[model samples]
Target: MTAENNGTGTPPPEGDDDPFAYLYRQEGGAGGSAQQPGVPRRSYAQVRAVGERQYGAQAGPSPQAAPGQQPGSGPGLPPHQPNAHYAAPETMPGGRAAARRQAAAAGGGPGGPRKNRNGLLIGAIAVVAAVIVGIGAAIVFNDDSGKQSQGQSDNNDVPGQDEDKNPKNPKDGDKKPAKDKPKPTGLPSRTDAADATLAGGATKQTEVAKAQSAGGAYVGGMDKPGASVTWTLKDIPESGKYTVFVRYGVPGKDADSTLSVNGKQSDRPLNMSNFAGAKKGDWEAGWAETYSWIDLKEGTNRVQVACGDSNTCDFVLDQFWLKRGWVK
Candidate 1:
């Protein structure tokens, strides 16, 4: 018989006479219609299998079942595979093991694929941070080195200033200090005959007190015609005419002597006509002779006296005087 829904939405109970009565009963209902006589009844397991094939797979009792699990196998459900389009939870945040540990810590059980993706993102952030830090460190190091080099350059500049201000010790590039120039001796100067440069027959010997010379010495023995005497004058104050006074004596007649200044001879030989005879030995009677003004150069000069060609024209030379003013 067909079952009718009571006013309370409940079906009537099945009759004791029909063994298939329970098959037509609604789940959790009081009763239902009996199965038809021509059709066979299906078991609970067969009915569930047909339902799974028609609709999508539903959640099983436990989530720990391995893949390809047969129905009715123990308590666990079949292994779950997430959609291929989504990134696996294991490859998201951390490695598979670490992700599993995190999931376990969060009470997510295990085998979470989203955690692995998070791990990849964290690793990327760490790498970017490291690169940034390295670049910053390199920039700082370069700046420090540049500052050191500039400081060294500044230090080098200090020495240059010192070299310019203090000239006692000079550096390689510093200019040398100027040397002091010699000053002129304004007063009259004299040279003794003994100090003269003698050549040929001229010689230095002791002379008597009457000799017109100091230092107890004079240049004598200049009897040969080729004998000569030279005196070096230095530190001349100015270039002008100077009078040369000679102290000399001739044992015989007056003599004629040649005078050369700076290798240039005088225009005329100096005539020695005012000779006084010697008392005893040669040049015992000394006489002072004055010459006309001669040109004197400023600085070192050579004054030379040579005997005339005749041997009798030679005389004893004691000393000479160079005065700035002319002789009256």
Candidate 2:
């Protein structure tokens, strides 16, 4: 074998060899210096063992020196030995043990103590409960407002409650009560044709049968223009609208007369149609009824039926009457 090969024939370095020796040489370390020309390099096994060394073990006996050399003398430096004060990370103060303790204090590490969760859970529950209470309060408030508003609406819908609570002024005693207005009693007040005043050739006649007037009397001679019969009504209960019903007879055809109330002429002539369906000149069978609306005073009023220039007044008046209100 060649002396440079050391009888190993250039085998690959072992796994435990220092791969970073070149970086140590660049930084000019004494341990990384170039070897002397004749000194042999040490093998990795002679340099340092791979496993941990026992720092506190008893020392073994030293090897005998060469015959002429000293006991500690060698051709090159001695093999690397572990320092006497070196310690493992697990055994040193403030190392792996301290780091594990710090991790446990800061909460759970990989498998250390677990953090507290009850506080967060309670806070979330309290928030939900508060929300529920707020919703309940809102519902109650809305219900109360709705009930109050409904009560006010009900009060407004009651009829005449305000009027009953507030009476009329005592100073207006002369005014009639609102409920005292006249209503129809279904009984009409009657005036016979004999009791009416006649003018312009109008005269009372008893010849017609079934007149409905006292003694079968009626007013006649109303065919001439300007002839009229006037009735002065009295003892009216109140001043209001009234209907004047007249009972009259015709000669079988239709006839009409002008009607005036309280001396004011009516806008339209009074209708005296042949409602009885009698033959011509059959005055007794031609008895029929007609009505006109008029306003009357509280105590007295006058109603007149006349033969105007435009009237066909062949009909005779038998009776006149008053109903309380304007009616058909």
Candidate 3:
């Protein structure tokens, strides 16, 4: 008998309604499609069961492996689990393996990785060598700079050195003024020599009417030709060129004489005539002065004043003076 609407198996109301619509319809908000409009479809629970058994719990099936083929277990590759976290180095197939094989073919053998490591090491060594060379060059350059600076400093000090060695070089136009030289001074001591005697004709000791000196005495009457007055100085402490100053009196006329010390004639003769005209008076009343110089020997000395060629000495000799040095 045919199942009717009232029986356990019932026919749906049919007015252009699909007989298999319920089979393809959504179940518990999950959707599935059928091969044909009238064909039945599997349920969501059944589809989920099939997927779990075919693939892993969380991962989809890899396209590289066929339906029955294992993952990462291709021919000429190592055996590996399909659900493992990572594949072995030898089992890393497909594009990565193909790339590694290509690299190995280009590089010679399995030693390609080692060669790459060696190349990296060589590159690092080259970088280090370059850095060291750069540092060495910098040090050399700094040394040269220091030497140049020292040379410059030495050059700068050269002028001062030269100035120190020769403080007054004529070539230096702009020079500081030189200090003045010291003036010449007179002799340190004097020797009084008033005692003398007549050495030749017409020369004798005379006394003045009025005292003008300590002894008030002199050598007089020197009017004869070849007459001379002599003095023998003793105990002379020094031997050097000495000055001889003569104090004398003039009576309105001039006198001429020459001096000799130790038998050596003076360089120049003396003229006592110039002293008499400066003052007009008697011979013994006014005194005048004249001087000459000669070298005196040590211990004792002999000085003689002789009349000139005119054969007459009119002046009266009063005293003698012996100084250490002569005037320039």
Candidate 4:
């Protein structure tokens, strides 16, 4: 029965603001009649069948083009597939999915399967979000790594000179024997030696004292009962400490030993004798040392020591590492 005769009819004026929209939804929207708001004069059997399968096998056209053709080809390259995996991208510039989606929903053309539209929306959003998050994390890590690398580079930098070259005192290698410095600052009062140790910047200080020896090497000390003036240091600094080093060998053999300073003792015993060395003609045994840190109240402190242990070997006092500060 026509709604008009039933008293529930809508106003029949063309001015009805929203008539077609209401009718369109009710008809699944493929068509409408001129006489009635939603009446379609024709019955669409196939269209109805396709629409009924909107969420199932009806999602897209059967993977064929005409009665007998392959899916990805017709004549030239089968135009790029519309990335149909997800809800077609929002308003993709090519206006492709909208018509199909509508036609399928309305049983008009190749209708899509009646799949859960909600799940597809969620999945598409998830993929896009994952890509964005991945890109963001990479950018942050890269920036942090760059800063760390810059810090390490700064630490490895050399300050004043060529990092590759070994450091050396400038006076080294000069031909002229460097004028002997007048001993250390207070060495004169300690013992009288022509030049026991270099005061200025000379690199090496050698033993120039006269001592007891049977062979080419000399060995002497306060070990027995005699006074042995091996080498006299000049003006030894009261603030700095002194280190005694020597090389020695036992009678006819090498022996280990250490030098005593002002009655001081070695943490370990000496290892040598004067003329008695490791090799017959070789006098190659000595220690590189620094003196124990000591503070002397006055200048020209008296310094004394003897060399020898079991065999009292011959020894040569080599170098002294001296610096200004008393606090070592």
Candidate lDDT (C-alpha), each: 0.65, 0.73, 0.59, 0.40
Once superposed on the true structure, which residue ranges of model 3 sit more than 4 Å away at CA?
Answer: 1-194, 203-214, 274-281, 310-312
- What would the per-residue lDDT of candidate 4 be over residues 1-328, giving only the tens digit for each residue? 1212111233334544442333232223224323233333123221331112322333543233332443345664244444333344354444767766666787555434335565688899999999999999999999999999988876685788656546666678647557975534433322222124322222222243322232232322323422223344435555544443332222234444444454555465544333433345443332222344433333444333343335343433332323445433
By TM-score rank, best first, the candidates go: 1, 2, 3, 4
Error of 4 at 252 (Å): 8.8
Candidate 3 total steric clashes: 0
Candidate 3 per-residue lDDT, tens place, 1-328, comes to: 2212211123435553553444454323213222333323333233321122222335553324333444345664344334334333454556567767767888854778688888899999999999999999999999999999988876675644563634666687877678875533433232222356675664435465442345565667666667777777776666787877777776767776778888777767766764545445465545677888678756777888887674346766666767777852
Alpha-carbon deviation at 198 in model 4, angstroms: 21
Angstrom error of the Cα, residue 92, model 1: value is 28
Candidate 4 achieves a global lDDT of 0.40
Candidate 1 vs candidate 2: the TM-score winner is 1
- lDDT by residue (1-328, candidate 2, tens digit) is 1122222334324552444332222211233334333333443223323222347746553333344553245554244334344655575579997867767777756444433466667889999999999999999999999999988876674554453544577686767557864653343368897789999999989888888887888899989999999998766767889999999899999999999988999999999999999999999899999999988877767899999999997989998887778898
Model 3 TM: 0.37
Off by over 4 Å in 1: 1-106, 109-120, 123-131, 151-155, 158-189, 210-215, 234-239, 249-256, 268-289, 297-300, 309-314, 325-328
Which RMSD values do the candidates have, in order? Answer: 17.5, 18.1, 18.3, 29.3
Error of 4 at 128 (Å): 99
What TM-score does each of the candidates earn?
Answer: 0.47, 0.43, 0.37, 0.23
Clashes of each: 16, 0, 0, 38
